[model samples]
Target: MMILRLALAAVISAYAAAQPASTSSSLVTYIFGDSLTEVGNNNYLQYSLARADFPYYGIDFSGGKTTGRFTNGRTIGDIISTKLGIPSPPPYLSLSQNDDAYLSGINYASGGAGILNETGIYFIQRLTFDDQINCFKKTKEVIRAKIGDRAASKHVNDAMYFIGLGSNDYVNNFLQPFMADGQQYTHDEFVELLSSTLHNQLTTIYKLGARKGLR
Candidate 1:
């Protein structure tokens, strides 16, 4: 009887220790980007021309509430989060009003945002990579406040960061300039510019402590 009680206590202690390990390994994914990844930040920007707060966008999502996700159903981030056994992140703007459920994940993506500082043609608000980084920094602070330093560090290190932005640069910046001048940059030159800008943005994130990142 004594031996059985001792073994039971050992098993209970092992289970308790394993709980944190399991959570640490549970893979937290943070998605950052433009309209493609903008789950709903545009909705909060009242004067911004990049608002998607309407139907048909979330027709396939739960309850069919247009959460400002640009895709007809789910963006790549949504699909990836579903695969990772977690819910898709909420927009950074929405974080203020929503409950703690969304504090764990954050989306800093905004419509018309680009890698270059001046890449968008929209006369309204546009988010450059620099602006996105600022939002990300703010979100990190909130995460730290909510989850503490250790869990926040684990989340940043283990989370998969997805960055998808560059399409707008081509469509809104390069194409328009080329059409106006009747002259176009060589494909290599365009690629070089995009690559250089992307590299700088990525380096900023790395310096900010993003360990697992994807672009």
Candidate 2:
């Protein structure tokens, strides 16, 4: 975990440094992923072991209370937002649909989530990548309602999307002894499946107005 944190920090720093000096502050940021980039989405889920909303998880954060992050402090999303000069987008489940916050961005990451719905079936319930995109579609509606179609269209198109996925697809699905994905598909076939799924997902988001993106 410590090594992962260090590597993530280095990546964030380098990514931030590469951004243009005069980047627009109006640039929105939408985040999606699993435990690695999750904020607090799983805390709202029922019957899921993929929770981080407990002691020892936020020992290094301000207030010293868990914020449902999968680490001791701020997530990569949070730090990257700071580096980019934008407020961290709040967790999707933590915000009301009617809230004006959607104009900025939202985080729809869940701790046990993956590209495939069955990746975290052992957790009973989780928001898969498909589910997250569906939620983002709803967010888009709200943004349109608040800002009107033209402006909302530009906002979404100009916004940056950050998705960190696939880890749980290995940790909870491909590597699980009881899971059938491995038995049903060879490693190469599994990679192809994931590739096709991701390509379709990216295409869906593009049709919905997501342009500038990162993953």
Superposition error at 38 for model 2 (Å): 0.8
lDDT by residue for model 1 over 1-215, one digit each (tens)? 23533453355334435545456345565676777778888787778887777767888878788888887788766765654556778777776732574346677888888777766646377567788788777766767787897876666766667676777776777777544311456767877878887888888888776886544
How big is the positional error of residue 167 in model 1, measured in Å on the Cα after superposition? 1.0
Clashes of 2: 0
Over the stretch 119-157, how does candidate 2's per-residue lDDT look in tens digits?
998888778999999999999999989989999899899
Model 2 TM-score on a 0 to 1 scale? 0.91
TM-score of each: 0.76, 0.91
Scored by lDDT, the top model is 2
Off by over 4 Å in 2: 1-15, 18-24
RMSD of each: 12.3, 2.8
